[model samples]
Target: MNLHSPSSTVADADLQERGGAPATWLPAVAEGLDIRRIFVAFRRRFRLFAAVALAVLLAVILVTLQATPKYTATANVMLDTRKERVSNVEEVLSGLPADSSAVDTEVEILKSRQLAERVVKGLKLEEDPEFNAAVRKPSGVKMLLGGIASLVGAKAPNLPQANSVEAQKLHEEVVDAVLDGLSVKRAGLTYVINVNYESDSPTKAAIIANKFAELYLLEQMEAKFDATQQATTWLNSRLGELRGQVQTDEAAVQQYKIANNLLSASGTNLTEQEISNYNLTLSQARAQVAEDQARLSTARSQLSRGSSGDDVGEALSSPVVQKLREQRAAVSAQVADLQGRYGERHPEMLKAKRQLSDIDTQIQDEIQRIISNLQAKAQVSSQRAAAVSGSLGGARGTLAANSRAMVRLNELQRNADASRTLYESYLNRYKETSTQGGLEQSDARVVSKAKIPTSQSSPKVALNLALGLVLAVGAGIGAVLLAEMLDAGLATAEDVERRLDTSYLGAIPLLASVAEGRTEAPIDYVMAKPLSSFSEAFRNLRTSVLYSRLGEPVKVVAITSALPGEGKTTTSICLARSAALQGAKVLVVDCDLRRRTVNRMLEAEPEIGLLEVLNGEATLEQTITLDAPSGAYILPLSKSNFTPKDVFGSVAMDKLLADLRQRYDLVILDTAPVLPVADTRVLAPKADVVVFLARWRKTPQHAIEAAFRLLSGTGAHVGGVALTQMDMKQQTKYGYGDPGYYYAEYKKYYVS
Candidate 1:
């Protein structure tokens, strides 16, 4: 079938547009994953991957074997909210709180340089070579570097020497070393803090860990004790000042009292006492005067009314009046008996009446005397009351004068009381704090003491090996990808068409497979294995060349490559043989006069070759030889160093091609590589179809593109590209996108 017929050409164009070259590349790139491509790339560069992976794994192994094993020991210290209480008094320094923040603070304290220094000094770590750099031996690498530096006369950097410096510097270095090995962290939002230390020796790790815990507790205790002591001292000093103030204020009160004559008696001043006494006395006197005046007025009222003093209460109760009344009663009784016995005007009756009258007079006299006594007592009481009132008035006047002086005294007394209260308060606090100094305790305690570790914590063999394996895999993958990116060669049919933007004719299998242990040239092998894949590929190439253009047939075909050893001569001869076997007359002309590889390939040592024919030394008929196996004509060159300028592009060469085109159905020129020689570039434009050849998986695409660019510049119709030396056995591994992908499965169709 003519591949270049209108229907076939349109079909090819549609196939390519739908899923040919563009499909091969787009699916690999746009989809972002092509497993077959990856497999092929890996297969091609597996050696590089292996080398990188092995090197990385070996380095890891060496480091793991040489590393010094370290042991870790941990001790737990918890922030204790519960502490033993000796007294009800509050502490000068409070205990640590049981919160995450508090635990974090304690963790920081454990990591502090202060505690680290304490541990270093307590454990005498400055003498240990593990911590003291000056005492430690130099490592092998460092010694080698030092030796190199000395040989080169390079001065070492000046660093502080621990032995030469002060003891403080050495201690500081040891502290820093201890801190570096120590890991203090709060255990997951808990009040318990973990104190971990790493060291070469298990015992050393345990000892350091325990030391940190012990020192941390001790630090807490000391801080509390110091705070208590400081509080006690301050209180003691303040108490002394307050005591002096109290004494001074009390003295001032006393002095003010003395100056003001405001001395107190029975919790009151003298004037106040006097005022109270006078108030009582005046009240009593006023009562007495009122009583006396009432008595005196009653007596005078009775006298003015012409009534006897018998109505007076004092007169009525008089003992003499009572006696007179009894005697009068007796007289009256005698008078009544006599009157009854005798008539009127009896002497005894008159005597009895007279006796009663005398008794009554006596009573009157007694009542009047009582009235006089009452009046005298009333006047005496009034005079005594007036005297008491005068004395009370004088005392009240003195009290008013003293009340004005008491104000200043009261202020002084208040000042004294405040000072005394303050002094007592300080004294009490001083006593409490002084007792607290000896009773201080730490806020934290060790919950778990560090024990000597039995197993090493570092240089874990299994873990290191796992990590090494992962790193090796990563490095291998990276190296493979890098090699793929750096490669510029074309391997498959898809690569030729997609990268070069040209038609892909076919892939020619390696000659060895077609020969199949038969000793024959490539052209003879093609003739011997006519049904083989090698011969089939050449027939496909011939069809593509003959039908590349619909209007005119491709009679003159040029076979060339970017570089030598690309199977260009074999392709030319095989293409000619394939056409000749198809019942068409074909001739192959070796245009490379410099190397003359076709003569060697064809075993033709003609005395008259293309050089002789073009230089007019011989005729074309004399120079031409026949490949008897395939019935193809060959015009090979003899071994020579003579190369003429523009020989292939000369008029004689054009005429020879024209004559061959007229006589033969097809004429093929096996030309030199385009990049190395100018013969192929000048000769390629004369052919109707130029088949650019590349070695499968061997020739770089940049070389092919460069050669194609030169050929196109010479106005050559480069029909397509074909890959020679294709490995059929390995081609299946490249997957379905490649031309020889099914070469293995289709081997049953071949007779070879």
Candidate 2:
């Protein structure tokens, strides 16, 4: 006998304490997952992962081998944005810096349809098999779709004929295709650009790439040349207009000069010279007037004092006056000698005095002549000064008029100078532009020409295989996890305790014959093979049932499940046989009236059973059928007129259970499923203990909870739950139950 109670190591109180806070179902599921469990899941599903990886890898290999090979070639062009302008004139066309917008514009130009069409026409790609689909073979996808449509009784669309309109449209299509294959990118942080093209032929790819670079350079040159020509034309027209303006301005300046009388004789203004001469003449006249006034005053003073000749300057300086003075002095000396020699009235003395008188008269005549000359000189000097002063005043008035005329002359001169300056400027620019027009150079040039590639660019074999393997493995793992999450079956004893909030008594291992091969009646096999794993598991279940209640053994136990086909009948029969083997009288009563499986398992056709005994048609002993091999009395369910609810709910049913409990040491009632019918619920309240059976990894958690609710609603004392038909190998593989622990730690102690 393997009688045992719920382990003291994990009592109901211990489980409640360890569970801590009451968690909802989702958290309980999250708590169940751990690194160990993930590892186990991956290990269990590794074959699926490998199969998926193999299939994907094989497909990758096929594609890599059969795919059409394409070749890519690149031509490098250097965009010299730092353009060296050879002239100082403002450029009408200039290169831009390698900013984002400039680079983007360059990229668009390289990818433009016009440029692509030019390339297509130059290469005659409209008739080329590579670029023109009309000339090329149909693609595999198109062929497959065509075949499918044909099988479905539908016709494929025909290709359009290449007429003039269609040819033009086809030409555009070819250009678009070429554009799609072209890629332009700036070589990082530099003015160099890379032009790449893909094609079926390496030589063709190289040819197209080199051609594109050449075309771009030619385009740049043409644009620059055109801009230079336009600038030259405009400058020429402007220069002609400026020349006419300059001539008109000069003529206007000359006309203004003539009208204002601004021209001067002797190349210098006459009014200015006249003003200078008049100023000099006025100064001379004023000096002469002063000299005459001084002379006149001197003469007047001399006349008043009877010494006019002496006071006059000319008289004082005259030689005749000096001679007269000397003669008079000699006469005075003779007169004095005669007076001394002879007395008064001598003839010699009188003659000397007369000589003195003559000398005095001559001196007086010279003085008068000097005075008359001074008067005439003063009159002429006064008249000349007055004439000079009047001329000076007239010259000053003319100078003032000339100064006012100068302002208007200056304005006309400024206009003439500005017009001449502008004409010269335009003329110089026109010359420079004409000289530099034909010498313009493109800012971009081809740095490297594309070469024929030696290897294909597409259908990378190793890379595709590697990627396929990774994706396939990921998908396989995802599928496994999804399947696991969707499954709601109970797999282990821990699941029962965690989900249902009930005690887990023990797990019953599935028999090897039923698990490994075809299905056989397990009740007969357990009796025949007593020492087998199946029998041993049932013995263990019996131990748990016997020790379930604390003070008393569970003598009257009812076995049921949440749903049908959950092994409750098998468990009930096995429990009875296991109890009888422990030297106790046991009775197995089949109370499942709707679908009675106990009689079929027992291999007996009974005339009377529990139904008859409850209806008072047969006694208890008549209803009991003894199984000799297991030493257990069996009461199979018989056909009855009444429904299960009426029979199981009657007072006689309660009395029959009481009497059977008294007679047998253990009365194991095999009841119908709680969720499927009301038989188990009606019978559960009369039993001392109710044991709910849950098929391992098969019964849904909600179904188990519903069954428990149904039984508890009738005040049934549910002792614990037992997991049935568990696969021990799988349990050990997933690390779920005691088998996982025992197989790893104590497998050496048991024979295989």
Candidate 3:
């Protein structure tokens, strides 16, 4: 007898399962997602992707078709800051420098309420049917939302009324709407500005755009004109005041001059001329006095020396005086010679003396005339000096008086000069302003007028459709991934083995009868058609179970699941039949007292089963029935009024399993789900190997883990896990794992 202990098999199977390579779908133990698995997931959930994509595409199409078309027209305005008035005064006083922020300012002005209002008024958009429709006719989407809200007992919003207050409100609303549709942008760094307006009516759009350009230019011209006019008016007023100030200043200067007696003659003041004349005449009189004094001293010296006036400068300078002096000298020499030769009364000496006496008399006459002339000249010089000195004293007094008044006179003159200069400057500015007032020019011009659009600008069909397609595809992929994440079902054998940490025995394909639309009672395909792929899968599972134990062949194998409807009973029946077909004696026992399905699958009519045997009302031999097709013994649980706990807890249940193990080569027990009841837990310790069954793509991974935890807590020997009722075609199509592909690749080998 091959007696296998549950501990030894469990230890060996754990080592074998753990030693196997990690599942390809989950290559790592961390949070890394395998791309291959992701592809499989998406492929498996392709229906969800298709449905989502189709729905999104349909919605996009509907919205695009129902959207209202709009036309846009643009007018170009050249904001030439260089175009300005050619007035130097205007440039200096009122012109602004070229500012970089001017473009942004112009854009804001274009978007301003005033400009919008002007456009509205010019086009009479308030009265246009198209413009009014935007306010009156609500969009379809909004109407639908409103209807939905009404159904939920919400009040719809009220529309504006056509009254004075509401009319004003509506007028403002239209202006705002116009503003909203307007777009103003600078064309690169150039001076050209594009003003675009969109509306339902092409003509209205064009008219509004053109009007905005025209209004902007007109506004600029008006602003410049107003500035020039203001400058002119201020200059005119200032000019009048300056003219009066100039007159007053000149008058004050003249009055100050007259009050101070600061009179002038021929560019020279009166006091200054009199002082010049007095100085000149005084200088000449002093010189004459000095000349007369010198001449009188010289004449008196000549008379005292008895040399007469012959040696004197004045007498010598006279021709008559010089001739008389010569005659006297000759007579003196003759008298001296006669006196020396003869006595005092000699006749020649007497005659010579007489001649000398006569000559001396003539010389005396000449000297007397010279002395008299010198006295007359000296007297005239003294009188002239006295008269000029008195006149100089009067001129010096007048000059002193004029000096005292010059300070105030100078201040008045400076005031007059400043006033005259300022008056002339203002007069020139006023004249320039008056001339430039008529020459003010605008800084912007309409370079291009807006024309009526021939085509709609909104609801770009091709672009919208392409974008919708891209979004739909993205949404579809997103939905698929989300569904894959939310669903934690074990889809493949790898999921059961790797995630649940269990041995993967094999996968049982879904029965062909079910696939072929034959809904009859499920049969053990191993017994019905032993050579089929389904039967072959069970045979493989049987081989794995036998080899699970290292030192001994496995006996008393228990098949169970996390929850009900995992096909545990079907798997157990098929495995038993496969073991029996190998010429091994196998007994299939139905341990689910609550829901007995094995007996139904085998068409067993035995009234006594494991429950009855455990209760001591029947023996194992009496309760067990032999199936004719498979020749396998089946111990069904008949209808009993006993709880699973009561039956599975009995000592007779252990004895019955021990006796069945001795009697059969292999025993298969189909127990209740580990999650729902304690029947599997109670029977698990009695079996040599425990096989956990997970329905393909149906059992949740957490559910299987929980079941394994429960069984492990109870010290049950979990041999391995089996994936049941798998669709091989779908598994291969989605590339779920290696098992499906292996089965597909070797399908022909199993056909014979």
Candidate 4:
């Protein structure tokens, strides 16, 4: 259902060929439009545009050459942006290193009025006449011109400060001079800038520029170093207050420990010593109890034996004779049994009794000794505890003192470490600065400094001369175009054929003027030399009239025109004579009552003319007079009370024209302007032929149209328009200058 492509029909291509793509070739929106056409058009008419450009160029050169030469000397000084080290420490702020913008700031400061005043004082540029001349106002010239122009209304500049006017003037002069001399150019993508000063003297210019850079750098360094010094002073004052605070804290801690009598001092909330000391005291008591049990056991063994650690088992059996015998029997029986195994009172049996006795005695003594030793140890431990408690009290006091001293010392040490770290940091930064500053890392370097230019860059002579030639030629072409576009008269034979649809009779050459003084009548020239242009024009008119309708000729034809001074009278008189020369009856009538130039140019006898006949004061037959035309007839105007319009429009005037038409073979009427009066209006209707006369370069198009409008209103069958007063010089200027220009190569049978 969709068919889309870059394909176009043949019609589209045709349209594009005829007129560029309507969508894409829009004249208004197109960029970089080809103005080549304009240039070419100017080239074809080059003499004009070039001439204009040349004149302007010459005028500028002349003005430039005549102008007084003012020499300018320029001096360059680099606005160095190298930074200076105020301190070693590099600041970290917002995660960025601090970069000083002071150099740029100084550049601006140097441009300020304060610095300008200083320079003025330093250089005394005001005293320099060259400096004053460089910035002089145009008031002197203005005052002179203003005086002359005052007649047409111009006023002088008003100075407001009347009292201190001279002082203000001097101050203004200095300010103006400084501004003129001072110039600055910033480096591309860099901190360096160029300061330039212009003066008549090269040394002065160089001095000013260099001095600004030096002074500004000094000012910047002082400001930054002073700021650093203030910071150091603040830090030192803070350090002193902290030291005093530490000492006071130490003394308070010591006194608290001495008064409380505490064995140990509280640590800084993280030391573990009390638990270790309690466990050590318990171990010492246990060791004393174990030693006492060992000593008591050895003492009991010494006390147990009757014979030096021996015991008697036979004593019970020997007990005093009988008892001793019974006891002895029991003892002997036991001994016998024992001797059976051990052989008669063996030392093992005695040792067993001795061992049992020793064990019993030792147990009793150990219990006593245990009691004594426990009591003694209890007493000794009591005394030792008292001594330990006493010592611990002293230890608490000493520990508190030491702890207090240690805490104060640590605080001071910590502060000292932080300060030392900061000082080291600054030192490191100073080392870095020493390297960087030495390198002078700025982007722009001076290539070549400005010096005094020997010559001004104005006024090119060859260029101006070339322009003048172009301008002159161009002006000539433009004048021709203007003349053509503005031309209103019918200038060519084609105009007659196109407008009238009639044969082009011919054209007439321009008359030099009545003052050029012709001795003979125009007919004499035509008759004497029929081969001449004047005669040829008349002959062509005669033939065209004769052969127009394939008839005998134009008999009793009246000639009239749209206006006067369009050669209607000349045409009329010439036509009549040319016909009369052919032996035809010819009558010339002066119908123009306003101007009787025909009668005047011909020097015809002054008598009652057309108005007299119309007023019934004279008959047309009776008023006919002659001068230049002896064989021909002329009807001149009478000094009638009637106007040209009245007499021409009257029925009587109609009868008179009819009478001439009937009476003569060729009758010609010279009429007034078809626009100004109804004379031509009345005559236009009556005459068989009506010719409109237009003067070259004189008759305006609108005037011609108005004349034609009058004729058309009257329904006059306007024959054609005739061009009069043609000049060959004027014709050549407009490229399509003459009708013959179309056929210059072709040999034309005729030309008007």
- All models: lDDT? 0.80, 0.76, 0.76, 0.54
Better of 1 and 3 by lDDT: 1
**In model 4, where do residues sit more than 4 Å from their true spots?**
1-58, 70-123, 131-163, 173-448, 458-506, 511-524, 541-566, 615-619, 625-631, 640-645, 729-752
Model 2 ranges off by over 4 Å: 1-39, 112-114, 137-169, 219-443, 498-502, 513-520, 549-553, 605-607, 615-618, 642-646, 650-652, 685-688, 705-721, 740-752
Could you tell which candidate, 1 or 3, scores higher by TM-score?
A: 3
Give the per-residue lDDT digits (tens) of candidate 2, residues 1-752: 11113462244345346433222123334567555556666666677767776777778788889988888999999877666766676666877666777866887898888788889888888889777887877799978976786565433244333245667888788888898778888888677889998888999999999989988888888888898898889989998898898999899889987997777423337888888988888898899889788977877886788763655677778889878877878888888888999854899888888888887778888777777777788888888888888888877877776577777778888999999999898888788777876666777888999999889888777788788778777777776665555556766666666656677777776766224563566777666656656667788777777777779767898998898998888888887887677778999888888777887777676777777788788898787888898899998877554453488889998788778877989898899888878878888888888888888778876677667656666878787888888777777644443454354455334323
Error of 3 at 277 (Å): 53
- Per-candidate TM-score against the hidden true structure: 0.59, 0.62, 0.61, 0.49
Estimate, for each residue in 1-752, the C-alpha lDDT of model 3 and write its tens digit: 11224564464366346543223344432568677676766677789999999899889989999988989999998877675536566432343335657776887887889877877887788876565553466788988986886565434245323345667887887877778778999888777889998888899889889999999877777787887788778878988898898899889988877876667523338778888888888898899889888888877987788875667788778878678777777878787887888967999988988888888788778778878888999899999999888888987776776575776777878888998999888888777777875576667778999999999998888988999899899999888757655556666656655556567787777875223453443464455567767778888898888888778768899899999998988888778777777888988888887778876666555666676777778887787788767778888877654562567767887788778878999999888999988778888878888888888777876677667767776667787888887878877744455667555677766532
Cand. 4 TM to true fold: 0.49
Q: Count clashes in each candidate, considering only residues at least 3 apart in sequence or on different chains.
A: 0, 3, 0, 11
How does model 2 fare in lDDT? 0.76
lDDT of 2 at 348: 89
Model 3 / residue 198 / CA error / Å: 2.6
Top candidate by lDDT: 1
- Between the candidate structures 1 and 2, which one is better when assessed by TM-score? 2
Our model 1 lands, by Cα RMSD against the true structure, at 30.8
Clashing pairs in 2: 3-543, 4-543, 302-308
